[model samples]
Target: MVIINVLKIVNWFRVTNSADLRKYDFSEELTQMKVMKLLYYVQGLYLKLYDERAFDNDILAWRWGPAIQEVHDKYIGQREIVGEISEQDLADFKEVNSDERLAEIVEAVNEAMGNMSASDLVRKTHEERPWKETEQSDVIADDLIKDFFDKNFKVSRE
Candidate 1:
C-alpha cells in the first residue's frame, strides 16, 4: 500500500535559487518575490489546465531535456509532449502556435508576461506591504491598481 501526506504536499512551492535571478538590482526584495510567485502560480495553473497523457500534447515553449530521464522535468515536455518554450518564443510570443487543447496554457503564459514591465517597475521600487496597521500618506494606491488592470486587459467584460 502507498501512503501520502496531504497536509505536507499542499500549497508546496518549488524553490529556484539561481544567482542569475538574484543579480538584478532590487528596490525591494518582497516586490520581487511577488512577481516570481505570480509566475509560479501561472505555471501551476497551466499544468492543471492541460491533460498530460493525451497524444499530441504540445507544450509550446516549455523547456525540458531531450531524454525522458528525470522525474523533475517541466513535465509539459516529458509525457505525451513535444517541444519546450524556445528563446524566440520567449522574446516574441507571436511564434507560439496552438489549438483548442492548448488555448488555456498559451493564455496563461501570455498573462504571466503581460504588463511584465510594470511588475519589473514594482520590483525596482522595493516598496513592500506594511507589516503594521498603519495608514498611508499616499491616497493614490486605489487609483494605481485600477489603472494597472485597465491598461493590461484589452477587454474587461466583467
Candidate 2:
C-alpha cells in the first residue's frame, strides 16, 4: 500500500546530492530537521501534482513541524546525515528517477528548500494549512495535505 519507503526517499536525497552526482551546490549541510521538512513538501506536492501519496508514512504535526516518526527515530541524535548509500539505496534511487514526474517533484523540492535552515523550514510548514490545522502530534491527513497543495501550489503537470 505504501508507494515508497520513507528511508528510500531519504536515500534518494543522499545519493542524488552526493558530490559525484550533485547537480547544484548547496552550502548548507543536510540536517535531520531539513530532511523532515523536505519529506513533508515532497509528499504534499506529489499529492497535489499526481493525485496520490508519495510515501504512505504518516506525517505528524510535531513541535518543530511536519515529521515522519520512523525517520526521526532513525536519525535521532544525528545533527548531520551523511550516511553512505547502500546497494538497495542506489536501486531505489534508480527506480525513483525512472518516474519522470516523481523525480521532478523531488528535485524541485530539494532545489527550492534544500538549503534553507531547519528553523526556516519549520516556520514555513507551520504557516501552511496542513500543519496549522492538525493538532500537535496528530497525523496530518493526506486529504488535508492534498487539498491545501491543490489550491495553493501551482505547477505544470504537462
Candidate 3:
C-alpha cells in the first residue's frame, strides 16, 4: 500500500539554518511566547525521534504536517511584509524558500500578512537542534525523487 511506500521516506521539517533561526527578536517581543510554545512541541518530538535514532535515512518520514507548522507559521505575510509574495494569495512556498515545506511555510506567510505573530518550524530563534540538520543534505530531494521513479521504486537502488 501507499502507506508502506510512503513510510520509506524520512520526513520531518525543521529550520536548521542558524540565520533563519535567529531572525526573531526573542528578547524584544512578548507575543513570542506563542511561538516559543510551538517550538517546544516541535523540538520535543524531534528529541524523541533523535534519541531513538528513528526516522533515519529516509526509512520513516516524520510527517511534515501540522506539528512543526505551528512554529513555521510565523514568517509568512498576507501581502508580504518583506516586499515579496503575500500570504493571502500564496499557493506554494517551496519554490520561494529553499528546503522549506510549502504548506506550513505559506500558512506562516499568510498569518504574517494578517498581523498575527507566528512562525514556522524553521524558527528565527537561533538554537541548536538535537536531530540531524535538514540543510546538511547536499542533494535536493527532487533529483532523488526522479531517481526513485527511474528505478521503479526499488529501495535497494536508492
Candidate 4:
C-alpha cells in the first residue's frame, strides 16, 4: 500500500511539476519555492471540491509553508524545473482529463496562482489553516485543508 501510494505521488509530481514549468515557458526563474507553494493551493482547492487529496504525497509544514518533500527533493539544487512526464504520467493525467470538472479546477488553479512570486505564495499559505495549525516540518492534515477551503472559500462540504 505504501509503495503504491508513493508511486501515485511520483506520477502526480511529474505531471503537475511539468505542467507548471510548461506554463511558465520553462523559465530559469521558476524555483522550488514557487512550485511547492503553487502545489499547496492546487491541492487545497481540489480537496475543497472533491473531498479528497489531489496528490498522494504528504504536504509537510516547512519553514516557508506547505512543501511536498518528494517534489522538493526532485528539484533540489536546480535553478529551473527540469523533468520529463513519463508515458505513465501522461496516461494518468489523460484519465484526469476525461473529467472536465477536474480539468477546469486545475486550469483555474494554475491561472490564479501561477503568476504569484514564491515569497507571496509562501506568505499566503502561512496564513492558511492547514499550515498554521501544523508544527514546523509536520505533515499538514487533509482534514484541516478541506475544512479551511470549505469554510473560507464557501465550497460546499456536502
Backbone atom clashes (below 3 Å) for every candidate = 6, 0, 24, 0
Backbone clash total for model 3 is 24
Residue 59's lDDT within candidate 1 is: 16
Give the candidates in order of TM-score, highest first: 2, 4, 1, 3
1 or 4, which is superior by lDDT?
Answer: 4
What TM-score should be assigned to candidate 1?
0.23
TM-score of each: 0.23, 0.88, 0.20, 0.72
Taking the tens digit of each residue's C-alpha lDDT, what string does model 1 give over 1-158?
Answer: 11111111111111111221365554222222233323333333333433121111211211210111111233322221112334443333222222333334435544544334434533522332211111332222322323333344343222
Residue 80, model 4, lDDT: 59
**Which has the better TM-score: candidate 1, or candidate 2?**
2
Kindly list the per-residue Cα lDDT of model 3 for residues 70-128, writing each as its tens digit.
Answer: 22344433222122333322322232333233224323433332232445342322232
Runs in model 4 lying further than 4 Å from the true structure: 1-29, 82-96, 154-158
Alpha-carbon runs more than 4 Å astray in model 1: 1-42, 51-95, 118-158
Candidate number with greatest TM-score: 2
Candidate with top lDDT is 2
